[model samples]
Structures are given as C-alpha cells and as structure tokens.
Target chain A: EDQVTQSPEALRLQEGESSSLNCSYTVSGLRGLFWYRQDPGKGPEFLFTLYSAGEEKEKERLKATLTKKESFLHITAPKPEDSATYLCAVRRWDGSEKLVFGKGTKLTVNP
Target chain B: DVKVTQSSRYLVKRTGEKVFLECVQDMDHENMFWYRQDPGLGLRLIYFSYDVKMKEKGDIPEGYSVSREKKERFSLILESASTNQTSMYLCASIPRGLNEKLFFGSGTQLSVL
Candidate 1:
C-alpha cells in the first residue's frame, strides 16, 4: 500500500524560529513529491516539487529537500505570514495517476 | 499563472436536496478533479475527468456523481445532500503528465443541514 506520513500534527513557533517538517512515504515507486501551503478555508497553494533524492528547491524563506524515503521542508526565520498548513503529496511511478497525500502539518508562527 | 475556478465559495443546502458544484479551468488542461477536505483528514478525491465526457470514480465517490461535457469544465453532483456531506470542496487541474503541479481553485465551504 502507498502511504504518506507527515509528522508534528501541529507546531507553534515564535517569529524568527527555525524548524523543519518531515514527510515520509512508502510507495511502489516514487515519481515525484509535492509541497503545498494551505490557509484556513482556502485551497492549497503550490510550494515545491522534489523528484529525486539529493534534490532540493527553495522559495522565499522555505527550502525543501528530498531523500530516498523521506523529504524535509525547512523554514528559516519564519514570520507570522508564513503560518499555514503545509501539505505533502506523492505521485507513484507504477502507473497510478492519482496523487497520494499526507494529513498535513499545521504551523503557527506567533509575532 | 494557471487558474482553476470554483463556482461557489460557500453553499447551504437542506438534507435530501440535490446539490451541484461547478468548476472550470482556464488552462486547457486535460485532467480535472473534485476533492472534499475536512479537519484531521486531508484532501480526498471524489471524482475526476480526463477528457470531454470521460469520468472516473475516485477514492470517495459514494453519493456523488460527476459530469464533464466540455474539456475545461467539471461538475460534481450530490444526489441527496446529508449532514455528513458538509465539507470544503476543492477543484484542481493538471496537464496530462503525472509530474505536473496541480492548480487549485479557492475552494467551497458547503454546509448541509
């Protein structure tokens, strides 16, 4: 069975706090991994895509790195505006078209 | 920027009433999807369409039906709305390729009473 797991269901950090959120997966074959940021009551916005191990992508204050079995979303000196639920989704290379998703990690940065 | 538009941001419906949710994408993407989200649970796919008049059932399709008569539009229908059906409905679109990023709409908050 293909599954995606995201750790730390919720996190609270003060402004300027740095942290990393984890996403691990078990699948037949890894096609790609996606990261999204979703604000309350709104649709998720695309963040990054990691296709292979040793690969990384960055935008603004967030950086995403990928490994063979997991991925990490690192936040640097986060601000209140960076607060949102971060979602992880994976695509299977074994002929499956749908993307499997993790429950997501709720992040709150207090100013 | 790729844009997926959901017709409603909020909706209120009575139990047993039929409901229709509409979504349209501006990008000429071949794939469109409908998903419902809730707290503690991530996005759950309800239905998807690959081409005109082509549809597929997703993970959670019970009590729901979909229509795709055009390439850019997809619709989700609830034959009989129920309280348990209340949720945030999201619409997304992607090109035919598997690695492409999904573009999403603002989503809809549906309340069934």
Candidate 2:
C-alpha cells in the first residue's frame, strides 16, 4: 500500500526560527510529491511539486527538497504569518490522479 | 493565478436533508475532484471527474455523488446528511498533465445536525 508519513505532528517556534518538516513515503513508483499550506478553517494552498529525487524548489521563505524515499519542507526564519498546517501529498504509479496525504504538521511561529 | 471558488464557506444542514456543494474553477483544468477533510484523517477523495458527464468513484465515495455538467464546474451531493458526515469539503482542479499541480478552493465547512 502507498502511504505518506509526516514527522513532528506539531511544532512551535519563536519568530525568526528556522526548521524543516519531513515527509516519508512508501510506494511502488513516485510520480510526484506535493506540498501545501493550509490555514485554520481554510483550504490548502499549493506550494511546490517535486518530481524526482534530488529535486528542490523554493518560494519566498519556504524551500522543498526531495529524495527517493522522503521530502523535506524547510522554513527559513518563519514569522507568525507563516504559521499554518503544512501538508505533504504523493502521487503513485497508478495514474489515477488521486493523492495520498499525510496527517500534516501544525506549525506555530509565535512573534 | 488559478482561481477555484466554492459556493459556500459555511453550511448547516439537518439529518436526512439533501445537500449540495458547488465548485467552479476559472482555469480550464481537465481534472476536478471533491474531497472531505477531517482533523486527523487529512483529505480523503470523495469523487472526481475527468470530463463533462464523466465521473469516477474515489477512495471514499459511499453516500456521496458528483456531477460535472460542464468543463469548469463540479458539484458534490449528499443524498442524506448525517451527523457523521459533517466535515470540511474541498474542491481542487489540475491541468491536463500528470505533474500539473492541484489548485484548491477556500473549502466549505458543513455541519450536519
């Protein structure tokens, strides 16, 4: 079975603190890995998509790196406005276009 | 920017009542999906449509139905609402390719009493 797991269910950090969130997966083939940021009571916003191992993408203060078995979302000097739940989703080899998502890591960057 | 919009942000329905949640995407995406999100379960796919009038059952399609009357619109229907059915329903769309990233709506928070 294809599964995605996220570590550190919750993270609390002061403003300007930097950290990384992990997303590990077990699947036959990895089509793509997706990162999303979801605010409380709102839908998730698309962040980045990493297709191959050793691929990395960055947007503003967030950087995503991917490997064969895991992906990391690194936040640089996060602020309170950056506080939200970060989600990781994976597409498997089935071409079904369906995604298997992790439980998400709730991040709080207190200012 | 890709824009996905849902008909409602918050909804309250009673048990046994039929409910409808509508979603529209400005982007001409080939794939559209409906998902329900819970606290710990993350987002579970309920239904998806590849083209107009072409719908498929997703991972959790029981008690739910979907309609894709047009290329840019998708709707999710709850035949009979139940308390357990209360959840945050999200809609997303992606372009024609496999690697096209999904764009999501603001979501609808539904409460079944």
Can you list each candidate's DockQ?
0.67, 0.68
What is the Cα-based lDDT of residue A79 in candidate 2? 92
- Docking category of candidate 1: medium
Q: Which stretches of candidate 1 lie over 4 Å from their true place?
A: A94-97
Interface RMSD, model 1, angstroms: 1.6
Computed on C-alpha atoms, the DockQ of candidate 1 is: 0.67
Which digits, one per residue and each the tens of the lDDT, describe model 2 over residues B14-112?
Answer: 999999999999978889999999998889889999889989998899999999999999999999999999999999998766675788899999999
Candidate 1 residue-wise lDDT, A2-111, digit = tens: 88999989999999999999999998889999999999989999999998999999999999999999999999999999999999999988543567789999999999
Indicate the residue-level lDDT of B110 in model 2: 98
Candidate number of the best TM-score: 1
What is the clash count for each candidate, in the order shown? 0, 0
